[model samples]
Target: MTETILLTGAAGLIGRVVHHMLCERGDRVIAIDRIGGENITACDLTEVHRLYELAATVTAVVHCGAISGPMVARDNPFLIVSSNVVGTANVLELARVRKMRRVVCCSSVSAYGNTPAGLDLVPEDVPLRPTSVYGASKAAGEHLLDGYAFQHGIDGVSIRPAWVYGPGRTTECGIRTMILDAQAGRTTHFPFGCDFYRQYVHVDDVATALVLALDMEKLPRRSYTITGGSYITLAEVAQTVKRVLPQADITMGAGPDPIDDVQARFDISAAERDLGYRPYVTLEDGVCSYADWLAAQR
Candidate 1:
């Protein structure tokens, strides 16, 4: 028998891809997003009553709905807390009340903001030291998942992905901006993040990790990190962009992104061994693909 799953954030970056993959694999998906689209149930994730209403229909929940990242709603910490933290609480409650078989949370790498100054590689076991409100919200959600699993046997897990990027992403992405500038014949200049190095995972790879977490009957670890398989600096990113658009003019300054200071790559061995997760997109290929998508849009 196929699993009937309730997938949130159905219209967002990774969520949309996961929705397509799940349906193509013959799993029934009840796709929901705060923003409504055709075949997507329009509802806020924090609406406890609405979430509960759909609980009976789904045997599992992929809680991808949340304030996407630190860049979003930087001015409104309340939205971040309410939508990410409280919304997570609400989803866990629905799973608890409904006795859902499993719940896989779409988490973030920012939760490891405090992963020791000297050592940068973040593993699942690192203490959550969140630097931003958005990071704090994601950390809180993971804690909630652990609590629910211990207390209610919810089979909850979190897939923490880093610097997620791919087609359909509407957020402020450095790579996307550079590619668009190249396509539009504009110079892309950044005053910072030249020496900064961080991870990037394609949205398709993130979807693969989420699905793996959902299908695994038993997970030895409650959380996993998914990355693009390497940490990339701005110079490396620029090089990849130049390969795609040789005429593109892009430059960066000497500092990192002001807010996102977590200069680290992720250890995916746990995710690899446990979930059979593998990142398929290389930086060059992902950038090329994203550029193709952006060009088509123009």
Candidate 2:
């Protein structure tokens, strides 16, 4: 099915990938980026009225614009709340007023913070326990989206993708940094996430989830969690890098990553059954892809 969609965060990693996917699949994309990029409109989503204008022309939205990650703007909780929370409200409102078809909100696994260690695959229904302000913002965004879908009678869904990593990544990713270190012939002294079981899905896999949510015949839930399908540690990630770059010398401390302590494994069966979602990028392949991409950039 073809859709005239408004895609926010058009310049970021997942946005860059999803924009191409939308256009390739014969959908009309009114792409906008807060930072401004080629063929992308520069606009801040927090400016509520600005996006409402697109509501008339677009059938649905792929809302990816936000504070992005908990690591970013760590010192500014207000920015996290405003951009992640208020920005979501604006998008939900636009969808509500226009009675748009659907809204695929780009949420985060950060929302499921403070999970019990080694807990069985965490499901979407788990009560959110956000530890940081950024995490709380994402959880709040999900609630806003869900409420809009129910009370306001608009179709909305949130994707809590695990630590997304791929090309055009503008944030600090441990995997990316380790690969970059290998490319630059530098020793890697990573601080954390060496033993912690965490998931890292590639940007391509995440873009697929966004598209599935946008084009699905029917959605049965308000949220979905996606991952690389394994609890991989930074130490394990380092080993994967060395598998590709044999000479890569990497060392990591033995502690939970300071950025987060959410160590619960995730069950993606809901996404698999509903969205027909299955990850295409394996951990080793993702490491190879990122390493090769980094090499070409230099």
Candidate 3:
């Protein structure tokens, strides 16, 4: 049966990938974003009437729209509150009123805030202690979904992803910047040293997890962590870039890893068990693919 899915943030990094995957699988996708695109309907999520209208026909929703990233939230706190918080409420409310089958919200690992130093393998049961406005907003969104699921009988799950990277990534991350610089044959000097570790999941893997959550007949857990199996340092990422593009010039500043103490590798066993999520793209393979894509674009 063809199911109609209302996908918010249809033009976003993750949204675009999910949209393509859903369409390829023969699902009817109703793509919407604040910014209009060729096939995406333009609408602000906070507009409750519009959301309710859109939800009337869709069987499920994959809510990926938000004011993402810490810096964006830090700079525009008001926008974050209105969009991420209020917008999330609107989405859940639509689910409740429309009797939608399911909703899969895209969350972030930043919701864990500053984890205790050396606290490896952070689990889903860990208490959320958000360190930034963006993290706080995502935490709030998760809580709202949980409440809706329990009280209003809405079926939903929130996926907390870490440092998602892939071909279409335009964000200013160390790995992405290095790949672009290498592709352009420019010497890249990153400020962070080699020991800085961060967990990354391929954008496609994250998309797969979202689809899995949507397809599950029943969800055992309301939330799950999805990340690359292990942590890789910035130095390692740069090395992968150089290996992919031999003779590429890249250097890093000398300093201790500033974020090492705060970051924790996620234990994705719950996602594996519940959603059948397994990250297939290794860091080396993902970087090499990204570098190749970059080269083709130039």
Deviation of model 2 at 36, angstroms: 1.5
* lDDT of prediction 2: 0.87
| Deviation from native of the Cα of residue 151 in model 1, angstroms | 0.9
Candidate order by lDDT, decreasing, is: 1, 2, 3
Best candidate (score: TM-score): 1
Q: Candidate 1 on 195-286: residue-level lDDT in tens?
A: 88878888899999999999998999999989989787887889888998998999899877887855566789999899999899998899
lDDT for 91 (candidate 2): 86
TM per candidate comes to: 0.97, 0.97, 0.94
lDDT at 180 for candidate 1?
Answer: 90
Give one digit per residue, the lDDT tens place, for model 2 in 1-298. Answer: 6879999988888999999999998999989878989978888987667787655689899999988898899999898888889988988888888888999999998998877666687889888988899899999999998888779898989999999997778588888888888788899997766787678999999999999999897899989999988787778888888998888899887888877755678999999999999999998898888877888888
**Superposed Cα deviation of residue 2, candidate 3 (Å):** 2.4
> After superposition on all CA atoms, what RMSD does each candidate show versus the true structure?
1.1, 1.3, 1.8
Model 2 clash tally? 0
Instruction: Say which prediction, candidate 1 or candidate 3, comes out ahead on TM-score.
Output: 1
What overall lDDT goes with each candidate model? 0.89, 0.87, 0.85
